[model samples]
Target chain A: MNRTTTEKVVKSLKQRHRKEKLFKAAGFASVCFGFLLVLTLISDIVIKATPAFHQHWLKLEIDYQQEWLGVDSLDYEKLESADYRKVLRRSILAMMPEVSGRQDKRSLYKLVSNNAEFTVRDALLKSPEFIGKKKNVWVMLDDDVDSYLKENTEFSQTGIRISEKQAGWIEQWYNNGLIDKQWNTEFLTSGDSREPELAGVRGALTGTMWTMLVTLILSFPLGVAAALYLEEFAPSNRFTDFIEVNINNLAAVPSIVFGLLGLAVIINLFGMPRSTPLVGGVVLTLMTLPTIIIASRASIKAVPPSIREAALGLGASKMQVAFGHVLPLAMPGIITGTIIGMAQALGETAPLLMIGMVAFIVDVPMGVTDASTVMPVQIYLWADSPERAFLAKTSAAILVLLTFLMMMNTLAATLRRKFEKRF
Target chain B: MKKLPIILSLIATSSNLMAAGRDTISVVGSSTVYPFSTVVAERFGKTTDFKTPKIESTGTGGGMKLFCAGAGIDTPDMSNASRRIKKSELEMCEKNGVKEVTEVLVGYDGIVIANSKATKQMEITRKEIFLALAKQVPATDGSEKLVDNPYKTWNEINPDLPKTKIEVLGPPPTSGTRDAFAELVLEGGCEQFAWIKAIKKQDKNKYKAICHSVREDHVYIEAGENDNLIVQKLTTNPKALGVFGFSFLDQNSDTLQGSIVDGEKPTFEGIADGSYPVSRPLYFYVKNAHVGKVPGIKEFLEEFTSEASMGEEGYLTDKGLIPLGEAKLKKIRDQVLSFTPLKL
Candidate 1:
């Protein structure tokens, strides 16, 4: 070969090497950018949610005088109907004797939770001997006070509702070591409340559970049956083809449209109750049915035709072969699809909004027919709240929801890994 | 999978229980009135034997649709509204079986134009605000003519105002707050011009079109119904203003301040009285047929109207509900106790 031809080949080889390096760097940079975005989002949510894990409690000396309660004896009826808030207010005023004006006293009383009286009453009811005694009790702090103590600093004091006097009192309590920062259990145990400090996600969690249970029970059987019939039984005709196309189309339809359909047909035409998990679950079934059916059909089709042919050669009936062999083999994929569908239903809020699930329900729903709100709707409501403490609560609720989704996906992965056969 | 039958039967039995009737009172209504109503419901639940009433913030129009559907267990027992029930709504209710409804005037709520505390508080008049935000403003020339809004900043509208761009964040047209603001602030300002005032009698629809249409320029941002987002945005952009309900101002008073309008600051007393020009009365209508059918409707009404809940110094005041005056409150209580059907 000539020298010029060899030189040209060498130069082109160098150029090709440079192009390969450039493409590799670009791909690595894109992956890094995606990771950085996700990391920033998760870290921000974790930081904002940290403050909600613990809450402040103020130690109070309550003198539950019988006179203040306006009850002669600690009878069950009298104790139940006693004026514990007056007693609670008296105890709070005892801490700040210098505050005499009506407004000052009212502001001072606001330092503790409005529900502290119930705490006091419950303590007394548990031990009736404390009715006439001065006992030291720890009461939950108000939401504003909790937020102030957590975020307040020498440089910036941005507590919107905390007044100067309230700040001073908080500082005094801090200096005197009367504030207890403890793990928050009420946030997990109670129901929704107008007060941010008292609100919890138990009501929403139970609602989600009930709604998902309904969705799973109704959608799985129906979805699997449709898929089995379509893949194993239905002849390849125009009708079946049209149905297959429509199922794929329905899978792409927006979720809110299903909500409107539920509102119009389920609630309006059929006379079903509103704001119940039953209606929410029914609406979500409509949404996830198409998805599950498509997934199940794909997995069912993956079963080898050779197995069916061999079973038929062995004199087995078609129904026996499909149910006993194909169905079992497709079970893993079917379960995976159903779990994914359930997870999607768990995070849905828009469709439920039309069925009247966007509500402020204070009770933990006991049954499918009870009025309830789910986790995403609860987060939306809390995020829209005027109270500043609800901001942290919203982030904390998001973390909880993310954890729930992660657990569900992990379960799906484990099930697939445990039962799936490569062949 | 074997337990599926049991679950299905359970759902069916529970729904049958629901058909027997709802024991707890159900309330649905305006998002503006939700804060006050929820607090009252909580108090009622805690202090009494009844279940806590479930509330849906379905807005005023949707609430009326559900409330007037029928006087039965399936429909809501009460509907709250930031405004009075319209005549058309009354006829619709009559068309259904909801023949009798008792209207209870709960309290008042003020709509405020607020800004971050970083900037000086603004004292804006209705005429200046109209000139600043209207889609069509009276021409600067002496002639009675309307043109696309030409003012770019507040100082251009009124020399006494600050020299800042006329950027305001507010709710969309779907929000009731936006409706009240159009009727109260925008229309109040439009009335200042003698020619426009004359046009109202001749062509009411034309006057509304002139007064109600806000500018489509980037100056007015439709920030959805989340009031907290608007508050956060105002803090970040100190020069911008926000329009929202007064409860938000009360909750975040330290970081935000309401702009004074027409010589009245949007205070509790100013709104409770007639001094605040942008305040509206909140009302809840109860279906009289469901009073006895529902277990705790009467008790819930008593708790809501008693001196402890809606009085001037009541608990609802802490949440930014402006209470009625003493005589008016007494008259309302009497009317509610009697379950008087609305005359309209």
Candidate 2:
């Protein structure tokens, strides 16, 4: 009301503005720093995981001598039974002339897998004609050899660890060009195994894909239909409200509980096969259903009431009004939510762990009931494996799962962008 | 933040305790060894006025990782393993500045294939067991092939065995039981099959190709880590067999009979006498560095592996194990008590 008071207020306002400006600048710097920290973390993850993707190769060109196979005699049993590995080892030694004179043949066998002889035996069995004939071959030593070469499994630790002799042999082999660890893309292409040496991600990736596919297939239609009924078709009453509350509660329920429910309802009562991806998918569906329904209903509610009124005014049937108009309009949100829900299901290890989806998945699954492992389960199993080197494989799997999420998010964004133009 | 004053007092007390040449010793390792060690620690602690040793159930690998995690001040004082600490893992321990680790082979783990005692015919064979559990069998080309339903529909891989649906409840990979099972049963036998080794080489896939390609109708169920769940499921389902450790079976054998593997029925007499074949050794690895730092550890370890810990009627056997016989027990006790360092 007075000039002096007005002057004081203006001065105070200016001071407040300067303080706010300082705080805002600090806030921006803090946010940027936080993002940088995340970037560093992500970079570390990428760097750590990249090594797992590119395996070291011990490519050896073994002479598959023809005469050793006894192919000329036409004796399949005799040819298969003969020790083809001796010729192959001789051939590998022949190829690498520098590594000779250091060790006996028996000692060389221990340098690689105890089963390397078996590998050679298998190759001979597959194509016995190659025996006694010179042919180039590439073989991977077990993961331990890889780790030993890569320096992940250090030899210098004083304890009952890797033998001094084994470590020395690995070094000698590397120096003499007898073994070279190379990036094996086959690791990614193959499936998980009990042997750490032969393990891959194929079983897990496909399991996640099939599980998510089944989840999407079952959850999307049923969820959207339920959402439509609840939001538009159902009578507004206490029962509906109760049902809605329960659905929300179901959404909040721990996923493991759903696994138990699936065990009782789907596996026990309905006779669905246990440990099947179908059962896993069904369990995930129950875990994800409420999420999809809630999102679909929200999207439906978001649509302007005028569109429905206009459709009715044009003599559209109730079904047409709901499905032909409202449903189409709510499609984007439904897709996004459904995908997000599926992604949520994708990362879930606990429910599947309970549902028996974490079984040792050897080959890729071909059907719904096929016993298979998902990516997270694969990561868990690999992490828990006795070999210390699978620690890298675990991170690599996390990278793949994160990539899946990124892909789903990209799809959601593209759909959202496409749908926004229509509205 | 809430315990500023309390923490200050605690720090002061710790400093005073440090001045007195004593500190709280943290011992974390195997759940299997936890029982034996905790009992020893409690008795030793009470007698000597030293603190009771701490233990954690983390499976063998996890316990080793924690024990060897070179966060020097935060490292565990000891590690326990149901199986031998793998060579690669021992390297990891050494790399992490855990210089001196004393590996003690405490006793044998007679891994019993447990089922509800109410069931009849509580014996299974190595051949039957192989047919029932092996991931691969003979397909074409004498190679290992996958059997999807190992015991789902029929009991007999051979005509001699009775036909019954095969359903097994077992521990997840997280448990020591699973480790022992994979090693003692799967590895020891699976590799023995001429057909299996071939397929394992050719396919190179883990268990998928091994698990799939079987009858859609045949039976196998993947039970998780909870031994209790398996026990419960076995009681309810007559077709089911539960695979668990010996301690659990010995504790609950009143209601469960040990399934004979390859006709060798699991029993105290059988195991101690080496007639039972499925049993494995139990082990504990103490951080040799912490011997003096931790009060009463050397004495406790000494007491743990004495004839008192694993005699014919030792403390461990009293709890729920079949104790080793005289000569074997003496050998094992000498090995553990002497603190002989392992070499690969």
Candidate 3:
């Protein structure tokens, strides 16, 4: 009987060990799955966005002929109405004189963008001396030509936006080393456009900067003061308890609900301009306040009781003990929390959309009241466009937004590690 | 205690500030109409002495709700729409004391079935599209009963079609483009079946269910309001198609092509003359009460209705707006300028 019982115990121990191994393997698999998902997401965005950073340009001898432009001097009005497109057409036709017919000529013009004429006009405005000269200029290629050069697309493909003859011309030019690939700085400098090539992130970037600045200025001090009063001075009563619970609940509320509140209260009641950074900031501030308050309270609570006691024993008043000692020690945690909250605000989209920040403003925002769009809103807009080129642009914008979020998070972490006190 | 009066006075002053300058005209409505109105508003702002009209792209239903809320300085002066005002919406406006609202027909926008330039230009009839996309297609063996969509590839629908898989990315139900497509393309095809047409007379709800519902399978992807993402997906997949406005097709003409539907191509002239199967008129309803009260309301309307803006060779057409016929354009322009209330 004793031998049997010992055998049974050994069998049970072996079974338990096998189960333990299985459990650990499952846990590890899930963690690895999460990491793989993140890796896949980042890689997908990077691969897609990398193409948008480089643009294709074709070298052409653009004849800034006075007859075609109808201007010999710097005349803004005359320059505006001038048939610069005719000059651009002449340049393309000069290259491929073999191509004839109205249809074929129209297809040949597909090599350059519709806005290529504007580029020549802009050059003339910058330097009036270039108006009468025939110069070899590197002009931006159309989106179709750029896609074809990227090798993912083919000239013979069905529904090819460029004609077979036009594609042949581009292929010949590319082989002759006339087509050059250059880094697209215009993507960083210009504003939004219906045309994908002309679209840039400057307007969205400035809008984000102004909105975040306003959110920080408004939420940080107000949130900190509310936390200070509640944690240090406010009486521990039903009213304070109720407020505390509500603040916690507020943090859990869906961001869209705050958008409704903004629309109803800030916009409908106060009559602030819709789609402006000012209203966007106000809405984001309200959405972020609970987070800032909760973080501030936790950090304030973490301050050592001994510090307060020492300050009080030194004949310092309650206000001075709280502000001068505890507040200083909790500063790092407060800032870290604020930064994380701001990062959350930066990624927010639905709330801003409700208050009219989704407007397509082409100009960079000059102030809080200017109609504008943030990074996420801009991403939403670009993602909604029907142009295939905007896909790469959207992914690029996402990468930029992700970089900002990561930097803010890294700063917060470094601050916490450097300044967080144990005592 | 000392700050109470100061705070009250500050609130009073700010409200006064808001009341003082009602110079900006507020416009709201469909995303489809937003681009056109914005372009016009920008030009109106620059060339004239007026602040740019603040326009918001609340979808058609949402905009109608706000426009019908009431007539006041706080309410929007105009509501742009991809569809005409519904009867219920008109009733609600009247109930809310919004007695007079003028409807201004802007122009038409074509809904195109486009795929990436890399793919074959599909020549599809509206019937094939309806059969492939509908949640319940009629029994192919000539029975009256409707069944779950079983067709997976284009070749299955018709042997003449390519053997590629049938994947169509389209907007959700909320989009005006989707509504217009359902009415124009889907319903137009649904009526071709004699039994289904007969069923429409017998049961309206069943007729709608059979005709309007799209398949929930992976073949038909509901790609939200962002048509650009659909275009991107089409480029990568090469086998997929997307539904969007003609302007998008015009802008990306180099990278995309609209499918020929019912033996008619989706072209500028085709849409303008109503030869294209899928086209809808765009409009904006103005609240008559706010016309004179708002500073730039009259000037903005005039600018929009002027010959230079809505003419055959106007800037709006350059932005891909299909110009209405001369007679229709003149009638609408006069109605807008005269502030003639739409008779419900």
For residues B1-344, could you state the per-residue lDDT of candidate 2 as single tens digits? 46546644653453344334324455555655554554455444433445545444456776787778773544567777878888888888778887667777777777777666566665566545655665555442444444343354333565554466676677665677766776667655555666655667677675334422222332445576545456557778866677876765654544567777777888777887777878877788877777776676777776676775567555466445566567876776676566666678
Measured against the true structure, the TM-scores of the candidates, in listed sequence, are 0.96, 0.54, 0.79
Q: Which candidate ranks first by TM-score, i.e. highest?
A: 1
Q: Is candidate 1 or candidate 2 better by TM-score?
A: 1
Candidate lDDT (C-alpha), each: 0.90, 0.67, 0.84
lDDT of 1 by residue, A1-423 (tens): 599899998979989999999999999999999999999999999999888889899999999999999999768888988999998999988877778998888788888987899889888888889888988889999998888888876413537688777787788887788999998888889889988888899999889889988898889999999999999999999999999999999999999999999999999999889999999999999999998999999899989998889888999999999998898889888888888778888889999988999999999999999999999999999998887888989998999889888988898898888778766
Q: What are the C-alpha RMSDs, in order, of all predicted structures?
A: 2.3, 27.7, 6.0
DockQ score of each predicted structure, in the order shown: 0.82, 0.01, 0.27
Best candidate, lDDT = 1
lDDT by residue (A7-97, candidate 3, tens digit) is 9999899899999999999999999999999999999999999888989988888888888877766677776657777878887788777
Candidate with top DockQ is 1
lDDT of 2 by residue, A328-382 (tens): 8988888888887888898898877555565444557665655577898888766
Candidate achieving higher DockQ, 2 or 3: 3
- Give the TM-score ranking, best first: 1, 3, 2
B1-344 per-residue lDDT for model 1 (tens digits): 68878888999999988888888889998998988889889888888888999999989989998899887788999999989999999889989988999999998899999999999999999998899999999999868999999999899988999999999999998888999999999999999999999999999999999999999998899999999999999999999999999999998898899999988999888898879899888999999999889999989999899888899878888888999978888999999989999978
lDDT by residue (tens digit), candidate 3, B47-78: 56677677777888888988888876767789
